[model samples]
Target: MTSFARKVANLLGVAEDRLERLAGGDLSEVLLLRRPDGRCTVAKGGAGIGTEAAMLRSLAGAGAPVPMVEGEHDGVLLLEHVENDELFSPLAWADIGAALRRLHERRGETYGWPVDHRLGTVELDNRQRSDWPGFWAEQRLVATASILDRPWRERVEAVARRMAELVPPDPPPAFLHGDLWSGNILVAGGKLAALIDPACYYGHGEVDLAMLTLFGSPPPEFWEAYGPLEPGWEERRPIYQLFPALVHLRLFGAGYAAMVERLLDQSSRNLSTTE
Candidate 1:
């Protein structure tokens, strides 16, 4: 394989004096390239990363804080490296909230993206659907159920069947950063730097917030700037969390299955409360 850094340099028409690989997760390898002029850019290489450049471009156009895509060749995606300027601050989280609000404002006619992308190594379904609940149930909940053990899989499928009733209807289809965990959130110099490694789609906006709150809680400033979430948002979050928990189960192993089971149980209880 032609090295990712070399491919990126050729595509960007630069002569790199230094190329250092950065620590990325299992799906992609990231390289930091410095040209003789001291300009730095990142090169991401993976088997199926070609669509990510287009996603970055689209998000940038919609005012989301994302890296500017420099170019691409083969599986190497060249993006303008954001220089880390500051640590995370209240103002930074607030800025992220506002920027994300702007991003969600840029909506589509249907729920999904133009192309499919990966949430880790697993395929994320972006096939458009007119109905949001059906999209979530089919694409997110049931589609991910296949990786579960037979009993858990059956239970999850039952939850999917109840999705129409479980989730409220007629919320506007909002753009989503399909995988929006805090790890994908970058901060520099106490300011929001970029949202990286997206699996873009159009769905319920709460999906992003659910993932953000999965590992840790977002600061109060973030919620203040983002505006109040939908009524009963706290209850709906576990249902949204199921997608990523299931993603973890598929990618990591059965250890994550317990988390998925807990979320399923919570969903079941919440469903009863609603009923």
Candidate 2:
């Protein structure tokens, strides 16, 4: 083990004889540590790990299924090893829907989290605001504009300007898993074991639902468990989805540019219909 890993193990009061690397996203390094007695723990090390630990604790407090935070020190976060299955059963889909519903029920008085967070190379400007439209416009949309080309930046700015007309002026500020895709979810024993790797904040609940649909659609069982959404959720979905599309464009490169343009066009149509 590296000196940092050894220090983390000592801080968490664990003695691990073996370390195995696990799949991780762009921002973090994940590893599984096993003791001679068969006990196991997962350690994630990178920037913002402590913040991830706090987010997990917050979600767990709100009755959402998440890995228990064992300890956090320096830049390392220790977590309980959660078993996950690659295949998601219908029961798991429904369970995730229900879990997400419960998570969104935990409301906040304002939009955004107390501290800013990062997604890939972009810093999420989570400065709390009372106005949802303003939050979405300035913090979510316009914040990404700096890294985009002039044309794309102009398009984003135009949408940001119309945020008040596009989104609700003041929806209930529901807690959100700011990054909610299939990959972040874990299933075991035909149920949702945990929602991991969160970039959490308080925002429109539809933001999460939109992100859930970004890569693919959830099953009908999911919607049935989640219940009906607000009437205009479909139209607002593109607006919410645009942020992640932009993030992907920035992170993965130009292949996602078409996805961004498509979502932008959809968002424009939504504006036209509203007008």
Candidate 3:
């Protein structure tokens, strides 16, 4: 067993009789821990592991479906093991929609997290900003400048400068699960089971919704149950999507760069129409 698995087992007051190292998609160690009694839990260890623990606590406290943190140590967190029973059904998606809406209702005073964190190994700046558009533009888009090609960088900067005009900025800030993609969404028993790996912050709730639709559109049931979206959300989705696309472009390179380009082009065209 890896030292990480043993450390978590010890922290949780269990023997490491059954420890299975699982596939952690990012820069972390993941393990399934089972005690002699057959009870199971998950252990994660790595940089920023504690940040996720804090997010799970906050999200669970706000009524979002998340695993209970069983124990935590330096860069290691033990979480309640939620068994996956089945994929999401329309009814399950409705539950997810309701849960996310409740989570968003937990508002914050500003548009950033209290501490800096990572979005899949990329350093994310959490410096608070009262203005949402400027916050998104600087923290999310323009932040990618150092990694991008000159042409792409210039285009992105141009859009960032015009972000306030292209995207509506009047929505009140709310709790956001900063990285709410399909992978972070867990389903069991044909229902939404848990939300994991949040890069939590205070922003428009639509930021989470936009990430959900980035790789693929959510089931229509999600929309039906999510209720009416914020005004101008449709017009702003492509712009919100640019944040993750830029993150991916920076992480994985040109394949995702194409996605960033497409989103920026769409946002630019939309800006033209508005003008």
Candidate 4:
């Protein structure tokens, strides 16, 4: 911990005896600190940690449960420490799906935040257009293409330009957990308890469901629970899933590169054959 870390601790009212460091991501360091009264706070210190802090604050009490943000210190943030270990079970999947459905059901005119925000490491601008296809093409696929390798970039661009016609314009837009992979959800007592790391925006509800299914659908129960609001989703699931594959390719490395390329090629073939 550095002077900056200490200052952040002071801001959270936690003293030396109370603080214990928790492993954090590459950019931030997290400390779980107990106060004199035994109350606990999760202090996160680093640059850009503020986005998650701000998002949690803005989306607080939007109906679903999440860590209640207490304070944001210059480059750090304090949140009510959720005291559960990582969700590591099959049942946890169902609970998370149910919780996600509840969140997606949240009604709003426009999905993205009014101001600029980051989705984990990626910058998000849901402020563009309410048109989901346009957003995916311009902001998501195209915006990230600059960093992708040449062959992969061209393939993604080709698929993206025609994505408007491939992805149907049905299923009225619902709030999406933009990045709802298995990792971002939290579970406790065998129940999905909270949502974290939102890249929230509005789009076809299937986008969230499709993402959940991307890394292998959470579990049978999860799909069953979500099936009511979203029935018969398999038809377009493959198409919707391309977004996450592309995201992984960009974020991780060449390992995901092949996966993205494969999906893009398949999508192009499917579109072309149909035409």
Candidate 5:
């Protein structure tokens, strides 16, 4: 098939030549065409968009508020093209929080995402780890610190090492979207229609909260729902945000470099205060 949607359709058992594409997004294109049942539905296709599709499939009908995937073709994912007004609104953010709260309430005996996916222009790897401190040290904090250069690199490593020791013990291992940014929240009818593009994994539930506030203030209700499920994590937001800031630092350049410095400094301050 010429279009990504068609490719996805063929992968999902639809005829490739008969496939048609409808719209496109940052990571994938959306398609509208006949399902084997002959009903029109949306499909997704592109580099690594399948990861996001797989994520949604795991959460589908779990009632946490996400789209449903019909099938796949090539690298394309056939999904319900949900019509939504906007993924970001006061009410939608609150619902997102509530939805996440319910999601985290489902526990696994581990810490890490089942898979990793990109965050906007950034790539986040969610390899499994036995402990949060080591996970943050090796994967999130230390791993990113290794990529830095000069004084800031040393500075981040020092802060990461210190924070790694001080970060609270493993509270509860729960599924996190791993990247719950404003862009991933979808709203319909002034309500949250779904949580799209999750880098699904099991880890500190608060990791999702940290990411929500990393770029900007997610709706208060979003945190409110998650907070009751796991409280006092707002205190550790900076530590979690450091991972993305580091990713951005590597991807965007000095602008993100400055953010890394600030996050490290903030992490040091938070750790000292709690100590």
Candidate 6:
């Protein structure tokens, strides 16, 4: 076993019988550790592990399904192993939609999180603001401008300036799973098992929906279970999507530049039509 794994085992006061590495994102290393008593725990080590633990606790407090945090020491976060077959059936999608709806029902006094977070090397600005557009414009859209090329930066700035006209000035500040992609969702037996690896905050709930649809479309069952959305969500989807696209572009390089451009084009077209 690696020293890190041994450290986590010692911290948890468990005898590690076996340790198996699990697939994880660039930001963290994930391992499944089995104890002598046949109990399994997941140990994660990397930047923001403590922040993730806090996010999970917040989710639990808000009645969302998340893995129980066993312990955290140094940079390693230990959590109860959640069983998953990684299957997302139609019913599972509906279940996820319903779960997200229930989560979003819990509102915050303002937009943004109490504390900021990071995704890989990118820093998420979570400074609270009374106006939704101002928060999204400064914190989400324009924050990455320095890392982007001139043309792309200009495009992003244009959209950022039009935030108030494009997005509702005030929507209920619903709790958001800031990163709600399919990969973060774990499923078991055709049902939603848990929503893991959240970059959570309070913002427009549509932000989660937009992120959910960024890489792929959820089935009709999802929308049905999620209930109705405010009008203009279709137009705002690209605007909301731009933040993640920009993050990917910055993290993964030029491969994602096209995605950012595509979203910018869509948002620009929507703005022109409205004008």
Q: Each candidate's lDDT (Cα)?
A: 0.82, 0.88, 0.83, 0.68, 0.70, 0.88
RMSD to native, candidate 3: 2.2
Q: How accurate is candidate 2 locally (lDDT)?
A: 0.88
Per-residue lDDT tens digits for candidate 1, residues 162-268, read 89777776577888877887667788866789999888888888899999888888789999999878888989999999989989889889889789889999999
Backbone Cα, N, C clashes tallied per candidate: 5, 0, 1, 1, 11, 0
Worst 10 residues of 1 by lDDT: 1-10
> What is candidate 6's lDDT per residue for 1-275, written digit by digit as tens?
77777877677776655668788656666888777788888988877888899999999888888999998888888898888888788999999999999999999999988888988888999988899999988899899766777887788898899888879999999998899999899899988888899999999999999999999999999999999999879989999999999999888898997898899999889889888
Kindly list the per-residue Cα lDDT of model 3 for residues 1-275, writing each as its tens digit: 66876787677776776677766556577888776677888888778877888888988888888988987777777788887655767887888888888888898888998888986668888899898889888988888565678998898898888988976675778899888987788888767889888899999889999999998887888888788886778889999998888888877777886788789889999889878
Best by TM-score: 6
Preferred candidate (lDDT higher): 2 or 4: 2
- Model 5 lowest lDDT segment of ten: 1-10
Q: Candidate 1, after superposition: displacement of residue 242 in Å? A: 0.4
The worst-scoring run of ten residues by lDDT in candidate 6 lies at 9-18
Give the distance in Å from residue 63's predicted Cα in candidate 2 to where it truly belongs: 0.4
RMSD of each: 2.3, 2.1, 2.2, 2.8, 4.1, 1.8
Model 2 weakest 10-residue run by lDDT: 9-18
The total number of steric clashes, by the backbone 3 Å criterion, in model 6 comes to 0
The TM-score obtained by model 4 is 0.84
Give the poorly placed runs of model 6, Cα more than 4 Å off: 1-17
lDDT of 6 at 222: 91
